[model samples]
Target: MFSGLFLLAGLALLLINYVVVNETVPDGTGIVSEVVSGEAGAPPPEMYDQVVPAPRDSGQFTTKVARTAVETFRTSTMRQLLIASGIALVGAAAIAALLGWLTARRALRPVHTITATARRLGAESLDRRINLDGPQDELKELADTFDGMLDRLAAAFEGQRRFVANASHELRTPLAVQRTLIEVAMADPTASPELLRLGQHLLHTNERSERLIEGLLVLARSDQGLVSQGPVRLDEVVASVLRSTGGMAAEQGVTVVSRLEPRLVFGDQVLLERLVTNLVHNALHHNEPGGSVVVEVGDQPALTVTNTGAVVPADVVPGLFEPFRRLDRSRRAGRDGAGLGLSIVRSVTRAHRGVVSAEPNLGGGLRITVHLPGLHRALSPASAPAETLGV
Candidate 1:
């Protein structure tokens, strides 16, 4: 709007200047010239001859007088108009710029509020929100987005605290049970074979409990810093996992097959190996007798573990990898796993900046895939061979 106004003013000024500068100036030629000499320095020639000119054959003496007056009027009017327009233009431009700046600042006020609110919020103060009451616009949308982010962060922090508490309780329960059993055995020397057997059972329970505790610890470490950035031989890691689980696979009539393509990746070797092992174990445990567990390492550096003959429950598959979320309560019912295998796989893969996905196989089974970054040459685990520490 302002630009249009300025352009119109400029055009008007140009038209006025054109009219003033281009008006023709007259050369005197009139009938009054016959009454006076054509010489200069004569005592003021007749007023008629001075103002008018010698008469021309074309009869243009009166036209000359009109033209002279028009020239004089245009020159006087244009000089005054130019001065006025210059002042007006500078004043209009300054006002326009100031108006634009003010409008921009007003439009951005909500953004400033959002920034201030976010800066004021911390881990302990995420409950606070930028409550803006205005018509729906981009600023309102931005505020809504900020509020959603805060909501998610609050829920996540709450979940973390709950997880820590639950894990601690789970770990302490078996230890407490084992401790009571051991105390009772120590108090009585004159005990039966059944009593000794009971003690043995408690010892086994304690061992299993210890494994769960260690697994939890490993998971926490994986979430923290155990997965380092370095080169690792993925083929070697898979080979190691296969060798370690070979005996377990044989016992369950689960034929272990590997179609590995040698590849290197930038990640912690132990974690990657654990991820594959857990997937393989998940497939084996959930399979029928004589079921095939196929571990395929693709040329694209993806690992796929597929098992035969086990239908996964629809609802259970969604939260299948969540920590402490079990698909089955009793081990005797089906696969008697601690239900931590998939969770651990997810954690380890995430630590190595990789992705893990589960899908139903075409031939009546489950297929799990792990895709991670890879390169040409193999890289080894830094510092130490990652081993499970029994805590």
Candidate 2:
């Protein structure tokens, strides 16, 4: 289409030049005056008026020379105009192309802002808004609308988090009081055996409820992102957890192994420890009678835990990280897990700006890996130890 328009422009310029050359240049220089011509408005010749006479060949020769000169001058002027037209046509096209590119870039600048805001958005980052500033046009309107949506989302999430944290804290006090009362009642001098058994049952239930509440509070906090960070020795955290849980591993006949590497990560130490503890507990709890749990701590991936258990389908593994999820409904996630082990692990890992994944082990088990931003710090050989339990 543009080519046709350019063709028409070129044709128009040529036609205009041709018409101008012919019509405006005076074709024969008005008969090439050889004798003096009478001035216009001078009286018309009377019936007896006398006129000057000239040689006929002389007049013809002057007229021919004038006609040739006019033709030559017309050719030279037309050639110069055509050359100028060609140069103007090419330069105009180049300028138009450059202007078109600049206009397109300016028009799409708002889209880049939208893309960057989208990339940064997350469950914890709902406060971020595009808030693009420009004219009251489509892109500006779109940005305002996006910012409004983020405002609503931030309010909603804040309310939800407050409710969960408050509800969890409020519930803990009652549970603690109930446990104290149950213990005090069972301490009576003549309490029946049945009463003692009932008290024990009630206490167990109360403890489970407390654990669930605690998990909820922690999950809510983690969803809000980290509050503070410091260099934490992740390997030492793992070693300490292994030592404390060694007796449980022996009791369950589940061998525990750990190859801890020296690594330092900047995060909340308490949350990181909770993250490792949950993984270790789940690994030990969800295994077969003779199953084994292997823990590895290192850089890059940060930590990995593999355990033998029932053959978990690949599809079912993802749900295991969700709250109140387990492989089998009848099965429990360790004695105190309350089905929130992996869920808490996931939240804590995310709070530290990391990623987690689970894969069904080929040999009837599950392997979970957590990747956190960290560095490996070299230490003496004896400072890092490989530990094995229940062998």
Q: Which candidate achieves the best TM-score against the true structure? A: 2
The sequence of per-residue lDDT tens digits that candidate 2 reaches over residues 1-391 is: 3445655676687678767765675443452342224332332132012221325456555445555555566677778877787777677766666676688678989989998998898766787889888899999998898899889888988888779768876888899899999999999989999999999999888888888888888888787777667899899899889988988898889999898878888888989998998998888877878889999988768899999987889999889889988678865433746788889999999888899999999988889999999854556455466778875
Clash pairs, candidate 2, are none
Computed on alpha carbons, the lDDT of every model, listed in order, comes to 0.69, 0.79
- Model 2 Cα displacement at 80 (Å)? 14
**Residue 262 shift from truth in candidate 1, angstroms:** 0.5
> What lDDT score goes with residue 161 in model 2?
77
- Model 1 C-alpha lDDT per residue in residues 1-391, reported as the tens digit of each score: 5555665676677677656554542223322232233443332233344345646553355445544544455566667766776777677767776786688788889999999998777544568888887989999999999999999987886676568668777878868877786868856889878878877767666766665676686676566534246787676787788878877887878787777666677777767777777787777777777878877776453788888876766556768889766655665522454567788888887766678888776676787888887775634434223232111
| Candidate 1 Cα lDDT to native | 0.69
RMSD versus native structure for model 1: 11.7
Displacement of the residue 11 alpha carbon in candidate 2, Å: 14
lDDT (0-100) at residue 71 of candidate 2? 56
